[model samples]
Target: MYVTFVGHVIEWRGPAPFYFVRVPEDECAGIQEVASAATYGWGVIPVSARIGEIDFSTSLFPKDGGYLLPIKNAVRKPQNLSAGDEVTVEMTVRL
Candidate 1:
């Protein structure tokens, strides 16, 4: 099954490098696991993942405060993404 989400590229900071797309405040519940962590050795850790295709709209903010990009359903190899390129990601949710 495939789902669709609309958000903006917020940032990219992961062990394997993932996009941080921000969903709107009202639609935030549609996505889950939106949390942050502060590790003493690893520094700040942002937790975000979701199911289905994530479509980043053209309207994006210049600041790095958008919703977290959903990497859970990434279809293509996650390493192929960049910092600022808006994309429509397709993926399968792992069970």
Candidate 2:
């Protein structure tokens, strides 16, 4: 499944800090409908994601009844992205 959405980059402070984009509610609902088929354990859905010209593979993390798409540092530096910057993400789910 292919989906695209614009979201802001946000920082999550866990054991280590990380950046992510929260999937919009409507889009999250759409993913949830097919999540059982696509998700591994813990509701993680594998997907190939692209932001600007950067492409990478990662899992959508379930949080607060939604999903957070991790934005890798490698993708961020070249793109000059930081927390609070709005980014458009294209994702292809591997079912």
Candidate 3:
């Protein structure tokens, strides 16, 4: 299925780097940073894969009031992602 997720980069940690994205209305997902580069003075990271399984039970509220959700087995990095950068992501949800 094609799903559109709009969230902000909340946290980026670990050696491989994982993005903790916060969607609207307290929804969130993790997008693994696969590749990154500076383009036109803007940092652009290409998240080419998803992780784990899509489960709603892992949802929680961020300290800032937004919901926190894991991107399962995210295959991307979480660097340069700030805590409020409006992001529109398109991905294929698999079962």
Give the top-scoring candidate (TM-score): 2
Per-prediction TM-score to the true structure, in the order listed: 0.32, 0.95, 0.34
* Model 2 alpha-carbon drift over 4 Å, by segment: none
Candidate 1 lDDT over residue span 4-71, tens digit each: 45544544566865545555554433222322222122222233233233332221222233334344
Which structure is stronger by TM-score: 1 or 3?
3
Compute the lDDT of residue 67 as modeled in candidate 2. 96
Q: What's the number of clashes in each of the models?
A: 5, 0, 9
TM-score of 3: 0.34
In the predicted model 3, the residue pairs found to clash are 26-67, 30-71, 32-75, 32-76, 32-77, 33-76, 33-77, 51-73, 52-73
Total clashing pairs in model 3: 9
Q: What digit string (tens of lDDT, one per residue) describes model 3 on residues 45-74?
A: 222233323222232224353334444332
List where candidate 1 sits over 4 angstroms from the true fold. Answer: 1-3, 14-16, 29-67, 72-79, 89-95
For model 2, state the Cα shift of residue 60 in Å.
Answer: 0.3
The Cα error of candidate 2 at residue 24, in Å, is 0.4
